[model samples]
Target: AYGFKTATYILDDGALNGLSNDAPIEKLRALEDQTFTSDLDFKAALSNALGDDKAKQYEAILVTAAAKMNSVLILCGILLFVSFYAVSIGPVMWVLFSELFPNRIRGLAISFVGLVNLTFAFLVQLVFPWQLSNLGNSLTFLLYAIFAIIGLLFIVAKVPETKGKSLEELEKLLVKST
Candidate 1:
């Protein structure tokens, strides 16, 4: 979308004009007739077509498109996080908490789990601003992606199969006698 938007903008403004026949913008001008297999392909081709000086002049255009794209991506991320929390994280914890404990200590076990969850939530809220300010958007998001992958690995390795098991069976599988 960004590449297409850029191509359209350049085409509309006649910015492709008056270049020496060998310039990268001239190559880009030729590409205006061809179909790109993917957005990345178009972007790569556009980058290849822009010489350093031309690319510098086009920086404002790319930055404007990037800002809009980042906003859209952030909105989508928030929506996805909310939906995932609603359907997965929020319920799964309670289910796991229920299944992991024996009847004698279920209530206490769940209270502990709930307390941990709340504490982590508060810590996240407290640290998020600092993370964003210190790491910047790209690195902050990269850190989130890394943590999500680590959590996924932990779930795969540590979480027991409880689908057909009773709470007692799950407790037996998940908990060891001390």
Candidate 2:
């Protein structure tokens, strides 16, 4: 629909003027900006207007444009998702790990916890396709959302504020809280 709109808009402004296919293309275009009910109707009109081969070429161009634009949109959405995770979840998770563990066991704890985190991340990637196929999109995404909400609750109820506090201070604070 978007590509059709763009193609029509371009064609309407005489973009294809003075060309060899001008008359036939114009014949297929809407004179009074009418709506096409379906592809069959449009194709039949185009075939009557300009024959099969020319109509196919025009349709191919429109379809290609729409497909390319759709791919670009999907790419943009993936980028946006990554950017949101980077800013909101990724760094905060590592910072929390650093602040939460005691100095005596910090290195070993961080290494073990980081490995476990990576393992879960790998598992999620591995299971995502299966979940999507079996549970469908809604359930898969809802499960992710539920887990995210649960993590948020855990952070709120359990993770202590390290704001304006040194590592030793934070360690002491956590010990006292526990």
Candidate 3:
């Protein structure tokens, strides 16, 4: 299973091959540079090549069967856990972006945020292969996890809770008078 997962990850064809339980860590560490015009294109290619839906179903079965959790299980668990954060963060960021700016400049603020978001997204795509090759998977993901924790902390500490507040109140709470 470990070998299969590693093959799915690192192989050129994105298929399970030449994998074994005792395969060297170097095999997993090896990466290749690839590019796509957009994230959607990359995702579509990955889903087609790697059969991500099949992986998801396999993971679900493994979880439901109460199998002995192995490396794949651990990785999948981490992936799913972070996936929850990914699914939640986008809408939260959008809502926060929309709410934080005053009505007078809201559109401009959103446009700015969108530009920044896309730029960083592009940068991540550009550097991810280099990060995987040079930093290795553990360190690469460690940095992501650390940053995610920091982001969560920042949101908790700095983002004002506007759940019960009216829009006008939120504007006053979030936006400055100036």
- Candidate 2 has an lDDT of 0.61
Tens digits of lDDT, candidate 3, 1-178: 2321232222332322333434322422232234332223333444454466643333323222222224676579588867887787776788877777788998999999999989988998999888764564446666766887898899889888768777788887765743
After superposition, the stretches of candidate 2 with alpha carbons farther than 4 Å from their true spots are 1-81
Q: Give one digit per residue, the lDDT tens place, for model 2 in 73-133.
A: 4456457758978896687878878888999999999899889999999999999978754
Q: How would you order the candidates by lDDT, starting with the best?
A: 2, 1, 3
Candidate 1 similarity to native, TM-score: 0.57
Residue range with the least summed lDDT across 10 consecutive positions in model 3: 60-69
lDDT per model vs. reference: 0.60, 0.61, 0.55
Residue pair clashes in candidate 2: none
lDDT of 1: 0.60
